[model samples]
Target: MKQETHTVKKEFIALMAILMSLVALTIDAMLPALSQIGTSLQVADSNDSQLIITSVFLGMAMGLIFYGPLSDAYGRKKIIYLGIGIFILGNLLSIFSNSFPVMLAGRVLQGFGVASCRVVSLAMIRDQFAGPQMGKVMSLIMMFFIMVPALAPSVGQGILLFSHWRAIFVLVLVFGLICFFWLHFRQAETLVPEKRIPLSLASLKAGAAETLKHPVSRSYMLASGITFGAFLGYLSSAQQILQHQYQLGELFSLYFGALALAIGLSSFANSRLVMHFDMAKLCHWALIVITVTALAFYCYVEVLAEQPSLTALMAYLAVTFFSVGILFGNLNTLALHPLGHIAGIATSVISSVQTFISVLIGGIIGQLYDASVVPLVLGFFFCSLSTLILIYRTRKTSAI
Candidate 1:
């Protein structure tokens, strides 16, 4: 019985990681193909290629607002199935799209479909764990989730060696199908019927109001969005900065993977560290570190009057993303910790606000790319600094 319990726990963690990872896989795996996609779709501005990334985020932001309330009324498993089905359909749409606008629409649909996984998985985690233990589990899940970003660009690049960019969507489709079945067969529904909230306009209004009213939940959700917006800026511009600005050529994937590995390793460390320290303290310090790192790098680049060397840029990214890794799990856990009773609705509201803010902030930063890293670095500094102020203002509140 003990062994069975252990097996279930391990499988549960792995499954949650994969479900959350679908978003990362969808975004990062397409980084390598962005240029090709833009060229094929005949985009007038090269920078417009970044929309392929942010459009999905825009979809996610829109979807999260709806998925949460529905998941609460329905069940997690049903929502997961629905999300995967929509994801597959979106992939097919993208595969056949001939115009940039149509392709973006497809990506938006993909984002909307996968938003279910993000809301449901986090709600499920809330169903099973709480407090620092919940933070620890989130960190562990993140450690695995981060791996997708580490390898996705490389996978996308490898696929391009022999096939067109559309083939990449096909690969994503297959992976989505596999994850769909994995959940269907291996995971039991975490939200029970008795605890299910009825879906209604009034109920959603109450849940949204409740989530917004909780000082810790509201502040942490905002802080999460503010901080992650910087990272999202990095994601939206990574291909342009690394491949076009730095001229890494085919080696872009290696550098990208190395930086992703930094985040993954930090998440692994956070999983253990959460057991020893307050999750809030970890997030507080992480915000400081990234804020300072971004400021320093911006100053160095400004003084040089040129883009920093690849070595300097990588060093800065490694540190900033390491800080980002610590913040991701801790911030989300803090926001959700006080709202577990309404996990589904709460996760939706938090995620929707967080993702919408990120997309708007990140999309602006990406559009500012001008063969220099100045805009991206400044974006990081401002976003991190803003989060630091937000987190400090809410320090008196109990994170537990």
Candidate 2:
């Protein structure tokens, strides 16, 4: 029975990962098709094209604010069903959108749909597990997400090759429906019935006030924000940088696939590394790796040529991607360590704050795109330093 229970939890977490993975795939998959969409919609200002990517994350920030508490009041299973239904609605809307503005609205709603799964997945893991083990589970879940980015661009391109870009939305709808079915039939409620809290106006006010006062929670929250913001920076611009700047459109898949695999492998390493080293130590080292790589890219872009080659871009950026695996897991575990009593509210608040800031920061920075690789490197460079400073501050406070 113990073994059977373990298997059930693993399978449950796996299902959640599948749902969360859609966010990354949906965002990146549209990259190769961005030009086609713009031309078809007759969108002016090609740079504004990234609105398709950033708007969803913006919606996710709003969704994260509610999903966790709803899951806490109800159960993970029910909230997830609502998220899927909404996600399907978004996909349908997106498939039919003929203009950039309409498409942007559809993407925003899609982000909202997935936010529940993203936050609730983390909460459910924290709901059932704790300590280093929780970090390990989160890492494993992220490993699957890393893999999604690897194939997602290629998969989207393959869909484009066979049909209109609208086909991508149809595919997303199919995937969402399948997940909804899987959850409806097989998954049990991870949150205990009695433990669920009523989400009220009073409860929201109290949860926010309480979370703000929690230093450990706030530290973890900042840690998650800085690193994830750095990641969002990459996600927003990497494909454009690789495909358009470097002119490697079709070949973008092989390079993206490699970098993504590096992230997954690094997460596996982090799960093992965290078992032996502390979270702070692991994260600091991970940043160091990324810093060195970012610096190298900056150097190459600044000095090398009229345009730095795609080879240089991938070589350095892949190293930067490796840090995401470590930072994503450790920061959350460390942040939530002291907020066990309010995991649902705290998780929701932290996730919303993290996504909200990351999107704003990443979206603003990504807008600085040029005909060169300078913007990508500079964003990574500055964001890495900001992350280091925040972690340093958090460490000093923790010691006090």
Candidate 3:
């Protein structure tokens, strides 16, 4: 019985990882298709094409606000079904879209729908685990989750060779269907009836207040927002930087995949290490490493007024992403630690607030892209510095 239970737990983790990865798959797979989508839709400004990524994040931020509360009341499985249904509908709209606005609308709907998976997965995990164990599980989940991003651009590029950009949406729709069915058959509801909160405006307000009252949660949420803002900036501009600036073109997906692989490896390393060190200590060190690396990279590019060789650039990015992999799971675990009782609404509030802030910071940084890596590096430096400050302040106030 003990061995059987351990095997079942491993299967649950794998399923949760796949569910969470669907969001990354949606974004990263679209990277290789962005240019084609822009040209097909006759976008005027090349920069506006980045909106394909940003719009989804915006929709996710909005969707999280509602999905959290709804999932808290209704239970995880039902919410996931609704979310996947919406995700498929959004993909269908995008497949049929002839205009940029219509396609963006579809992407936004996809993001909104996908937000359920993001929030509910975390809530489900929280329902089962907490503290360092939660951090370890998240790291394990992220290890597998990061694999999707590493391979997605390659998948996207492959599809583009055979079909139009709209076909990418068709692929997403199919992926959603597989996930929906797998979830329906294999996963049981994690949220229990007695624990369900009443869904109402008053409950929403009360949950928000309850979540915000915790200083540790508030501080870590802010740190996560700042750190992810830098990541978001990178995602929004990675295609342009690799293909246009470095002129990698067909090799762009390979380079992007390599960077993602770095993050995956780091997440795997973090999973092994979290059992020894606390999440807070690991997160602190990771923030410091990323901040220092970004500063060095920014100075090297800004002072020399020359682009680093591809090898040099990748080395720096590898280090930055390695630290980022550590930071993400730990920061999220730290933020959600205090609100486990209300994990659904708490995860929603934390994710929504952080995502909205990241969208603003990242969107502006992406817009500032000037065929140079300086803006990207500076964005990383500032965001990591802000995260470090928050971490310092939070630790001084209380032991998390």
| lDDT by candidate, in order shown | 0.92, 0.81, 0.91
Error of 1 at 297 (Å): 1.0
Query: What digit string (tens of lDDT, one per residue) describes model 3 on residues 1-400?
Result: 9999899889889899898888998899999989999999999988899999999999899998888889889999999999998988889888999999999999999999999999999999999999888988999999999999999899999999998877877887888888899899998899889999989999899899988888999999999999999999999999999988999987899999999989999899999888898778888899899999998888888787788888888999999999999998999999999999889999999999999999999999999999888889899999999889889888888676
Show the colliding residue pairs in model 2: none
Off by over 4 Å in 2: none
Candidate achieving higher TM-score, 1 or 2: 1
Task: List candidate 1 segments past 4 Å from native.
Answer: none
lDDT of 2 at 207: 83
| lDDT string, candidate 1, 1-400, tens digits | 9999989999999999999999999999999899999999999899899999999999999999888888888988899899889999999999999999999999999999999999989999999999999998999999999999999999999999999999999999999998999999989988889999999999999999999999999999999998888888899999999988888877888889999999999999999999999888898899899889889998899899876899999999999899999999999999998898999999999999999999989989989988898899899899989999888888876636
**Clash list (residue pairs), candidate 1:** none
lDDT: the better of candidates 2 and 3:
3
List the RMSD of every prediction in angstroms.
0.8, 1.7, 0.9
Off by over 4 Å in 3: none
Question: Which window of 10 residues has the lowest lDDT sum in candidate 3?
Answer: 391-400
The Cα error of candidate 3 at residue 144, in Å, is 0.2
Clashes of each: 0, 0, 0
Q: Which candidate should be chosen as best, given lDDT against the real structure?
A: 1
